[model samples]
Target: MKTKAVRLYGKNDLRLEEFELPPIKDDEILAQIISDSICMSSYKAAIQGEDHKRVPKDVSQNPVIIGHEFCGIILEVGDKWKHKFKPGMKFSIQPALNLKENPYAAPGYSFKYIGGSATHIIIPNEVMEQGCLLEYNGDAFFYGSLSEPMSCIIGAFKANYHTESGKYEHKMGIKEGGNMAILAGVGPMGLGAIDYALHADRKPKRLVVTDIDEARIKRAESLYRAEEARKNGVELIYVNTGTVSDPVKYLLDLTGGEGYDDVFVFAPVKAVVEQADKILAKDGCLNFFAGPTNPNFSAELNFYNVHYNSTHIVGTSGGNTEDMIDALRLMSEGRINPASMITHIGGLDCVVETTLHLPEIPGGKKLIYTNISMELTAISDFRKKGETSPLFAALADIVEKNNGLWCLEAERYLLENADKI
Candidate 1:
C-alpha cells in the first residue's frame, strides 16, 4: 500500500513523499502511525544530510524515511501474533528496534530499523519476539513519542552520579537528591527533564534550568510555577545565555560556590562540555544528555580535576522498554505531563518545514498527528478510518483556543479518563 512519510535525500533536504510499503508477514504487525514528535537529532540529520547516524550507510546514499518517536495503533497483526495485538487496538510502537546484528540496536536511534515518521510501519515478528510493544488504550498524544527520551532520562538517573548516603552525614553526591542543572538547550527534551526532576519524589533541594532563549526560560518558569504549587518555594531561574558574558561564572554564582550536585548538560556545543568541569560541584556528576553527532568531534576538560574531584561524567542515548513503561506510568499518574511540552502542532507535511527550522521556534515540543486530515492538517495527521472520538473532538476545540492550554489540559483529561481509553 502507498504510505506518506518524510524522506531525507541529502544535506538540508527533506521531502514528504508517497511510497509503497511492504506488506505484513505472518509473524509481523502493521501499524498506522497516529502521532510523532520531532526531536533535535532529527533536525541535526536534516542539516548534516547523509552524515546523520540515523540514516543507515547504504540508505543514507539513497532517500530514507526519518523519524523515531511515535505512537500508533495496530492495524494488522500476523496470524501467529493475533493473540498479542488486535485490529483497532491502540498501542505505542517503541521505534528503537535493537536487532542482534545492529551495533546500536537500541530503541529510537537504531540504524537498522526504520522510524515511525511514516503513515504506517510493519513490526516484524523479531520485535514481537523481543517484546517491545506496550499496550496503551488511553488518551495519548503524538508527543507520547517522547517516551524514548524520557527513558533516557530514567537511564541517566539510574547511572547514580551521587555518593551513597551513610547513616547520618549527608555527603553531597549524585544520588537521589543530587541537584540537576539542564544547560544550553531549551526544547522539549530539556523541558521534559526539568519537569521530571521537579515532580520526582526525590527531587533535588534546588533544580536549576538554563537556556539561551529568554522566552523559553520565562515560559519554563511560568509553567513550573503553575504546575507545582505546593513546591512553589523551589527556585526556578531563567538566564539569557545569549547576552551573558560568562555563563559558567553566572551559573556558579547562582549556586553560591557550592556547585550543582548533578548537572544535565543538554546542549551539544563543544564549549558547553569544555566549561562543564568548572561549573560542576567538587563531587558533582555531569550527565551529557546531548552528544555531538560527528564521530571526529571531541571536547576538552580538565583530566586532573576529573580524577581528583571524584566527580562523574556519564552519557545516555535512547531508552529501553523498562524506561518506557515507567514513563507511561508517570504520564498516566499525571506526574510528568508529556503533552505540556508540545508547543507546535501540525500535520505530516509541516514536519519538514517546522522541524527543519526548529532552532527558530521558541518553545517545547513540536507535535505531529499522522492521521490528521489535509485541510485541518498543519503539524500532524490522525484521521483514520473511524470518526474522531468525542474526547479528541473536544481537545481540538481547546487546542484551537490556546495551544499551551491544550497541553496543560490534555494531561488532566488523560488522567480523568485513564481507565476508559
Candidate 2:
C-alpha cells in the first residue's frame, strides 16, 4: 500500500509525496492520523530543509516524514498490539522516542513510524508492546501528535513549578504567585506556555508575554481569555517586542521595579539571552525553553550576577513519557482548551503551502488534517465540535471539585509512564 507524507527533499524544500508502506509487523499497529499541530522545530526544518537533522540526503539514504504533534485513531492492529488498542479507538501518542528499557531505544524519529503529517503511521513493535500513551477517551482528537508538545510543556512546569515552595517562600515556583516572563516569538509553544502559566494551579502572580508580532499578542489576549485569567491570581501583560527598544528595562518596570522571579526564554534570540539575565530578580531562575540549533550555541553570563544574586539558568528539550501522560489528563479534564489554540486547519495538500507561510502566520495553533478531506467539514462546524468532548466536561468537574489535584495527579501519571512508552 502507498502512504502520503510531507517530505523534506532539500534545503527550503518540501513536497507531498507518496511511498510504498511496509506491512504491519506482528507486534505493531497501523493508525490513521486525525490532526497534527505544527511545532517551531518543524518550522525550522521546513525553512532550513537539508540542514535539518531529521531530513536525510535521500529516500534510500535516510527519509523523514515531517510533523511530531498529532492525534489519531487505531485503524488496524497486529496480534502483539491488539491487546493494547482496538480499531476505532481514539488516542494521543507520546512522541518522545527515548525509552529507558529498550536496547535499541529507537525513538519514532529514528525508526520509520513516519510522522503525523502522513495519512497513516506504522507503530513499531517496540512502541506497541511497551504501550504508547493511549488513554481510553472517545473525544480525544489529535492526541498522538499533541502528546509530545504537551508532555514537553508539562516537563517544563514540573522542572520549574512547585506547590510546597510557594507556601514557604511566598513564591509559586513559576505557577501562580511568582512573576514569569516568556521572551521569545509567540509561536504555538510559546502560546502554550502562556496558557499553562495563566491557568497554572498555583498561577504566576503576573504573566509577561512577548513576541515580535503585535497581532499574536492581541490574539493571545482574546483567545486564551487573558481577561478572565485572574482567578488563579495571574495577571496578564502583553508586550510587543517590535516596538520595545529595551525589553529588559520594560520587564523590570512591569514587575514593580523588581525583575521577574522566573523567565522562560522561548525564542532563542541572542538578545533574549542577554535580557533574561538583566531582568531576573535575585535568586530567580531563567529557563531557556527553546533549544538552539547550533551545536555550539552558548551564551555569556555574568559570574558576579550568578554568585551574588544566586540565579540559575537551565534548558529542557523533548519531554519524558510522564509529560505526555499528564498532557492527556490535562486535555481530558478541561483545564486546558487545547483545541482552542488551533487557528488554521487544512489537509495534506496544504502542508507544504501552510508550512511555507508559517513564520508569516500569527498566533494560535495550525492543524493539518491528514486522514480526511478538508472539504468534509466547514470551519464553523470544526470550531463547534472542538470542545464538545465529554472528557472536557469531566475535567471541568475535576477542576471544580478539589481544586486541581486531579490535574496534578494526571501529570504525575505521565512522569511515571515516561519510561514505558
Each model's lDDT comes to 0.66, 0.65
What candidate 2 gets wrong by more than 4 Å, as runs, is 9-13, 46-62, 99-108, 136-140, 161-176, 241-246, 296-298, 360-363, 373-421
**Candidate 2 local distance difference test against the native:** 0.65
lDDT, candidate 1, 1-421, per-residue tens: 6787777777787877777877777887888777777777788877876565555555455576677778777888889988778988877656556667664443333332245667777766667766778886557654367676677777666664555334433333244554557787466677777777777655676677777777777767766663363363345665676688988888888888778778778877887776676788876888787867667877887778677766668888766778788887787787886665676655676777876787787666676765553222222222231146654555555565654444546434433432310
Cα deviation of 267, candidate 1, in Å: 1.1
Encode model 2's per-residue lDDT on 1-421: one tens digit a residue. 6788877655567677878888987877787776677776777766666555554445335656778776777888898766667898876666555556533233323444557778788877666545554653735465445667867876776666322323544332454477888887366787677766766565778788887777667656665566677766677888886798877777799888888778888877777788888888877788888877677887777779787876778678767776777677776676765544555545677777777677676555666667544422222343244377443344344334542222333223222332210
Evaluated at residue 269, the lDDT of candidate 1 is 80
RMSD to the native, candidate 2? 9.0
Q: What's each prediction's clash count? A: 21, 22
Query: RMSD to native for every prediction?
Result: 6.3, 9.0
